[model samples]
Every structure is written in structure tokens, then in C-alpha cells.
Target chain A: MSEAKTSANPLFLREEELRQGIELLFFAYRDFTSEADAMLAKHKFGRAHHRVIYFVGRHPRISVSDLLDILAITKQSLSRVLSQLVTDGFIIQHRGPRDGRQRLLELTEKGVEMERQLTEAQRRRFARAYREAGAEAVEGFRKVMLGIVDDPARERFAQSRRDGGRDGGRERDQ
Target chain B: MSEAKTSANPLFLREEELRQGIELLFFAYRDFTSEADAMLAKHKFGRAHHRVIYFVGRHPRISVSDLLDILAITKQSLSRVLSQLVTDGFIIQHRGPRDGRQRLLELTEKGVEMERQLTEAQRRRFARAYREAGAEAVEGFRKVMLGIVDDPARERFAQSRRDGGRDGGRERDQ
Candidate 1:
């Protein structure tokens, strides 16, 4: 029972109202990634590489198939990007302990540092926004984001937070 | 002010907490675009095209230079994308009335229809999320997004709403 619920207009789903939300999402996401993107450009890498490094950092021994599922990119696309990462030494593949044929992905020390740097650039925005909005607004923000993402199953960090506590709030993508 | 302000932990800036925010942003943004991305694939258009259409739709007579500034892309990149949109008949170019050489961009009728479809796919998620979160949460969500975006000067929709009422609530990058 929010005050906004009782006092706010319920008919905010009109096309115009919805358009504003769309614009906010566009600007927010664009600006959000721009910082990390600049850092990536220095390495002659792009978003594809940033994503591979990020997910590998998050999942630590993530299988190629699993990564393809999460990234929703084609194997050919991933192969091109993955090969570059391997050649450049940002990522290394390991044979699955149980399945010798499987290639599991993990980040190298250099890869980890890149991931940390990228995360740090983007994290500053979230940290500032969350603090400025305060806890209630942050809760509302996450709730709306959860709905927008439409993948509660994928947001394992949120799930983990609910089940317990203190797990470096990063998404596991597992 | 709010209950979460008092009830929630004040010290959430720890690295783990910050990292979770990063993860949520990654998943939320990725899923947010994936739906529209599917629609884009059907038309052989990518995110770059979607952005051009969306912005041109938002600002009907947006000039090329203004667009370049808003998109933060190189002239070479915008030229490739813009020419395609014009050739494909999704957009039309006009010479500025006052400035003979100024290239003004506007979406053609076909472009408008395409823009609507793309926005429709994305709007569904926001509609559901805003409704489920209630008005208060929606307010909170907007506040947080405002901070994350850090472009109050650009989000003229929120400003216009503050000045009065009903404006179809779309951002004007001008």
C-alpha cells in the first residue's frame, strides 16, 4: 500500500506515458555502458569482448554452451570473439574435470583486472544512483528492473540475497 | 522520509553490494533489449538503426549534427546508418528551411510504423513492471533511473511533466 498507489493516477499506461519510460531506459542503458565502452576501446575490443570477459569473470568455469545460452549469440559469433580473447590472453579454456571434451571458460589474471576496471567504471553510476535515491527508491528500481528483465531465475544474486546474505551482489549468470 | 531509509542498512556501498548492482544492471539491460532485438533481426536492422528511428521519431525535425551529438557516434558511423534508413524508406531527409545545407532527419510513415512496433515490444515489459510496482514504486524507480542516467538536462519529459500535465511524456534530446 503505497501513497503513490492511492494518490497516483492508475491510467499511466497510455502510449505517451509509456514512451517516457522507453526514453529513460534508452538513455540510462546507453550512458551506463558508455563508460565501460571507452575503456574497452583502448584495447581494440568492443562490447562483444567486454561481455565475454564479464561473464567469464562472473561464472568462472562457465561452459561454452552455457555462455551461448546466456549471451544469446551465435556460436560463430562467440567463436570469433572467444578466439581473440584467448589469443590476447584475457581468457583461458579448461577441460571439464568430469567431461574431458568440454571446454570451460575462465579469466586470466589480466582478464580479471580488465573485468575489475570495467566494473569499477560502471559501478560508480549505480553506487551514486542508489545512494541518491535512498533505499526505498532503490528497492522500487530493482523491482521494476526485475519485471523488465523478466528473468527472476537468472537474477541469482537477488535470489541468493533473499535466501541468505552477503554474496557480493554480482549476478552469477549460473 | 521513507521506511526503507530507516529499516534498510545504510552501509550498502561495500564492494559486494556494489557488484550486485552491476550484475542486475547487466541482466536487466540485456533482457530489456533482447525482445526488440528479435524484432530488429526480422528487419535486418540493429540497435543502431533502432536508436536512429526512435530519436528521429521523438524529435521530428532533428538535424544531422544534433543527432550526431545525441548519439555520440562518428559521422562515418551515422552516415552509413542514416543512408541505409533513407534508402530503405524508413526515413526521409529535408533541407533546413533556414540553413540551406543542414540535413534534417524525420521518419517516414513506414519508419513511424516500424518505430511503433519496436517500441510496442519494449513497452509491454515496462507497462507490466510499472503496474506491478504501483505508483510509489514507479516514482522511486524513475528517481533512481534519473540518477543512473545523470542527464537531467536531457530528460525534458520529466521537466515538462513537472511544469504541467499530459504531454505524451517522451524525452527531447534538445
Candidate 2:
């Protein structure tokens, strides 16, 4: 770890900075999810539910396997949360058109409303941060975070970005 | 939400950018904790256990209430995780010097070793991201993340940075 410091590299490889980075991620992520958590609690939903709603809202007609791959949770675990969403009328499942056996998930109208509310709270924070940090800082922030994502998933993330806002979920991997 | 767009301010206020920010956080945080979660599972522990060990490691002699406040978890929820840590000899609670009734928590030698291993994994990822993104980007990343943290905690975070790398947990709020 100290090797980077010993070399003539312009970068300062201080352990202190590394630790601060870790703490920033911890506190920032905690505060980021907090508001959504409070609102989810009112509906008796957990963070897991929020993830499902957000993803389904982003990529409509997302297959169960794809969601499992994205969330990286067991089918058994997802079954309980997904079932609750379906029963509560926030999520609906449709049989894949090309493959009848596959179950593709989408948010109901109510689910869209819920997703909008939760997302609005988060966007407010991000918007404020972006406005304060300036465009250059926002770009730097995105570059650093994008660098942190796992290699394989980076492409999928970029694809989602290109797909743009709520309505465009065209990249069906069914 | 589009009100910001129609404003005379120079900020772009694009919804696409805001959505990308949300996804970046989700993917980045998920990948950030993946290594720790795997390591914790080997010991039959979870993220909650990791948080207990992390805070106790960072703030040696941290009081119970302070830990509870930082974690924002109920006393009941914290009790289960704390008991497991103590039982496993990862953390030891000492009587506060000024107030014997108050329990101050710190990591045992075994706990320190575990915390080091966990933190090293995270540090490596952060270091790589920092190096790739350059110093300016690193500063920008920190600025934006700091902006996201709630106001009160931000002061404590900065104080911890000034204290420089662990061992200075002297600000007792008992």
C-alpha cells in the first residue's frame, strides 16, 4: 500500500485519504437511503422492496432472471418481496412474448406513482449536490463512481443511461 | 421537477443526469460492500455486524448511545449485533472513565485484525479509483459526497479527518 508513496508518482497515496473515502461512502450512502427507508417503512416495505421498484421502474418488462442477476439475491428471497409487490398491485408480471415460460416484471400505475415519490426525494438531494458542486465536480463524481462499479455490470449500467428517462426500457435481454 | 429546467439559472437540470446519479449510487455502493459481505458471511456475520465492528474500530471508546445515533438503528436491533460481536470476542465494552455507568466500546486485537482486512479491501478499490480519476477528480468526488452527508454529521466527519487515521477517539459525548 505504501509502495505508491515511495515511487515518484505525483499522486499522494495516503492511508488517511483512503480511510476518509471509505467513511464518505458509508455516511453518504446511509443518508442517501434514509429518506426512502422512512417512507418505505410506512408501507411496510424494506430496502429490498425499494430496489425492486426502482429497477422495474427503470427497465420495464425486465425478466425475473435479469432482476435476480442485477440484485444478486436468491430466487427464494426475491420471491417473497416480489410476491408482496404483485399482491399489493404495485408490480405486475407478464409472460414473455417470445418466450412464454419467462416472467417479465413491470410496475403498475400505483407502482409508478410510488417510484416517482421515492425518486423525487433522492433527486432533490442529488440536484442540490450537483448544483453546489458544479458541472466539473459532478462529472468527476460520476467518473470516480463509475470506476468503482464491477467490470461486467458497467456496460449494462451505461446501456441504462443511454435508454434515458422513465419510459425507455427497450433493451430487452429476453 | 421540470420547474428547475424552466428556471433562468444556468444549471442544465436534466432529469437524465439525476437518474444516472441514482443508478451510479446504487451500483457503486452495492459493489463497494460486496467484498465485505462475503467476508462477514464466512463468520456467520452480516452487514450489521460489519457496521458495529467498523464504528467501534474507527472510534475507540465510542459510547453506546453515540454508536446507536451514528447507526440510526434501534437499541433492540443494535443489542443483537453487539451481543454477537462481544460474544465472538471481536469487541469489548469498557466502563467510561468519567462515567462508570456508560459503556465505551472498542475492538479487541482479533477485532482490529478483522477490521484491517475488511478496510484493506475497500481501501484498495478506493485507491484504484482515485488513481485512475486523478487528484482533481478525487477532490471533486469528495466534495460532492460531503455535500450529500447531513449537516451535523459532516462536522464530525471533518473532525475525524483532522485527527488523522484512527487512535483519536477522544471526543467523548457521554
Candidate 3:
């Protein structure tokens, strides 16, 4: 069957090729995280810690609820990571100017430096991949990723995309 | 200074872009695994179990040592997942034809069915992404992923790529 028909119909799902994609996702993700995980491990942190530092560093002064929405995890999950970051002085949390219930998060100087190191390694990988793939492929990869996001998450993702534009996608790159 | 330089020099990485890549990795990966994780959770199995099942199913008659190599985990790690699969009748393990020390693995009928369901969700996601991204982007994504793979794992990935040629990259989907 034609590729278009096969994809559109869903009934003609090529089982074997799809499985390879699954494996690819597995292997690719394993490799993708290994570098950052090693760095976090050295710092006595875990992937959870990395996620918190990452998002907070991305949108400086972002509120707790906004972070919870972006990360799509329970407050408890975010609380554990956030508390650790705050205690360790990597992140500073303060009451929002307008909403006391909302905690605004920003990375400390040390936190910024550490986040840089962790992110730099990942950037090297992506930069290489993007360069090797070229602009067309990079755009394609982004679109594919956007398509794969779940519906609800997509809304949050879109909001981030809009906010990201104001920053010229700078926060996204971080 | 320019995009070209940033793209070309791995060491001269863009902090913002790199951070964005990290978030992309985090978000993309979470979305990527959610489908299978949900299915596995329903079965009281985690991702670890799915990995064991997937590799064994992919390489029928694969040996214990070979599996460890592919999984890049300790035998102890594989043991827990592998034993559960074997005990549950999802996989059948037999003494190697020539080497008694080596255990060869294959999926039972039930295992095959489970594998199908587990992979179908992922395949649908990938198929949609691939079609939306088009063939060029798909190729670039694969190339970028291949680049991210470390040296030791690269060989195994290459071997799989070759093996995949027979089914036109459908082995994993199956």
C-alpha cells in the first residue's frame, strides 16, 4: 500500500516498522539522557532534579503552578524536586508579586552555572544532530515532535511556544 | 556569533538553544514512553519488562549474554525482568543448541500478542510523526539519533539496522 494511504487509514499500520520506531525511541532516549543523568548523578541528583532545574532556568521567575503545568507532573512530584533545589541553593523561590500562593522560581548564580553545564552537553548532541540533519530535517523533527504531544499537553506546549516567541525561542534553547 | 558557527562548533554551543534541546528531549521522551508505560502498568509490568520482551522478541533464539550486551545492563537487571517474562509464559527460554551455558529466547504466542499491542501504540505515534515529517525528516531524525548513540552501542544499532533491511525496517514494528 502507498505510504499516505497506510498512515491515513491506520488499519494498514506497518507493524514491523512501527516496532523499530519504538526501539529507536528507546535507544535514542537512553543515549539522550545518559549524559545529563551522569552529570546529575555526580551532583547527587536524579532526572527529577534535572527537570526542575531545566524548566525553572528556562523561564526565570516562572510560578509553581506554571511549572507544574509545563512539567505535567503532580505538585508532590514537583514539590520534592523543587524543595531540593531550593534547599541546595540552586533555585530561589519567592512569593509571586500578585499571587502569594504562587511561588516564583529563579536559578541562583551557582544554579545557572550548573544548569549551563548540564544543558551544554545536551546542546552539543542536538547541535551536531541538527547540523548533520540540516534545516529541513530540523524543521521536520520539530513538527513530528509537536504532532506526538498529547492533546492537553499540546495546549500548555502552545502557550509555552507563544511565550517562547517573545524571548525569540531563547528560553527554549536553554 | 552566527547560527552557522554555533551549528558547526560542538563546543561553541548556544546555551539557550541547548537548553531548549534538553527540554525537547525531556518532553519528547515523556510523551514517547507514555503510551507503552500505560499499557505495561495495566499488566503490572514496567518499562524494564517491556525492554526485555522487546529485545528477545526481536532476536529470536538470542542468548543471555547477547541480551545483556544489547540491554547494556547488568545480568542482575535483566534477570528480574527476564525471569518474570519466562515464568509468565510470555517468553520461552531454552539451552543454546551448541552452548549449554547460553540460554536462547523466543516469544510465546501470548508474548507476541502482547508485544503487538505494546508496540502498536508507539508505531501509530511514530507513523503519524513520520508521515507528517515526511521521508526526508524521518531519515534526518534517524541519522541524528544514530549520531547520539555512543560507540559501543553503535555496533549493536548498526547490526539491527542491517537486520532490519530484510523486513524493510519492520522487525521492531512486528
Best by lDDT: 2
Q: Which ten residues in a row have the lowest lDDT in candidate 2 chain A?
A: A4-13
CAPRI class assigned to model 1: acceptable
Model 2, span B1-174: residue lDDT tens: 355433343444367788788877888888999999899899999999999998898788888998898788899999999999999999999998899888899999999999998777898999899889988998889888988889756765565544463544445565
> What are the Cα lDDT values of the candidates?
0.76, 0.83, 0.72
What level of docking quality does candidate 2 show? acceptable
Residue pairs that clash (backbone atoms under 3 angstroms), model 1: A168-B16, A169-B20, A170-B20
How many Å off is the CA of B145 in candidate 3?
Answer: 1.8
Residue pairs clashing, model 2: none
Model 1: runs farther than 4 Å from truth?
Answer: A1-13, A152-158, A162-174, B1-13, B150-158, B162-174
Off by over 4 Å in 3: A1-16, A153-174, B1-17, B157-174
Per-residue alpha-carbon lDDT of candidate 1 for residues B1-174, written as tens digits (9 for 90 to 100): 233332245354355466666666777777888888999999898989998998888778888987777677899999998899999999999988888788888999999999999888788888898888887888888888788775642555555553222333442334
| Order of the predicted models by TM-score, top scorer first | 2, 3, 1
